[model samples]
Target: MCGAVKFEVHGDFDSFYLCHCRYCQKDTGSAHAANLFSQSARLVWLAGEEAVASFTLPGTRHQKCFCRTCGSAVPNTHIPGLLVVPAGCLDSELSRVPTAHLFTSSRAAWDHALGDVPEFSGLPKAT
Candidate 1:
């Protein structure tokens, strides 16, 4: 993370999902978005509140908050009594794992063969 934005989740998260919807894919610039949902978790920004910016997908409830400095995702209030946390943004370990994959029908075609590809400890050297 950019270190511009820091936060803590005080309560337990109730659900976790890897969303493959188009919006999520676009926002994350990946195949899916890993999100943790909580009804009671509190988000307390420790710094760079001024650098944090949030955008609600024009006509939908889908929203995203990120640090303008490095464009890293940050915790944000989703709605009254609800909070959505991008799993990648956490500096600490999660108490539990992702519960499910959502909107699989909309997942990218290239994403389906990812697991079958070769694995590397780090970036593979150029041929």
Candidate 2:
């Protein structure tokens, strides 16, 4: 099991996004990443805030965070309450439940094309 970083969902998930954008690739140190986008009011960090470290990219507002101890990416916010937890950071049960994939046009060729999940060349149509 991964280290615990607790939070509460303030609103229903607005959408789940699978980002194949270069920023996601660099941030996750992988081909792409899955994210749960929710309202900022829905998230609260219960512990381990001290172990989290974040970096802001040169031209983007997005900030990514990870655990300094284990090097596992931790959830950070785009707004308030909205937590972006790396899909791998979740247990098996949660990891399997992705809502959608974003930036599909930029996905790597070798990556398993998730045909079943909702996929968008960019962010999916709102709601």
Candidate 3:
């Protein structure tokens, strides 16, 4: 993620959700977005705060925060009283687990039963 931006969440997360909404899929370029939500945590930028940027989908509550240099998804607090953090961007491991998969009706068909697929240590050693 280029590590251009560094921040900290100072309090425990309220919930975690794997979001399968179409907007989430498109923005993440994946089946779903794993996000941690908190209403009380404070977000403090540690470095490269100037590099943080955000985009909101027109007429919708959807928003994405990212590092402008790397385009990696970052925490968003544009929504009042809530902070949304992309779980993948965290540098450390979390004890909390995903509470649910939201918007499952929009989940991609190909995303089903992915645990059955072949596992790889690292890209199958590139063939």
Give the runs in model 2 whose Cα sits over 4 Å from its true position: 1-11, 112-127
Clashes of each: 0, 6, 0
Sorted on lDDT, best first, the list reads 3, 1, 2
Query: What tens-digit string does per-residue lDDT give for candidate 2 at 31-79?
Result: 7788766564345667777777788887887678777777777667755
TM-scores, one per candidate: 0.93, 0.68, 0.96
- RMSD in angstroms between candidate 1 and the native structure over all alpha carbons: 1.2
- Report the error of model 2 at residue 21, Å: 0.6
Q: In candidate 1, which residue pairs clash?
A: none
TM-score of 1: 0.93
Task: Give model 2's TM-score versus the native structure.
Answer: 0.68
Q: All models: lDDT?
A: 0.89, 0.68, 0.94
* lDDT for model 1: 0.89
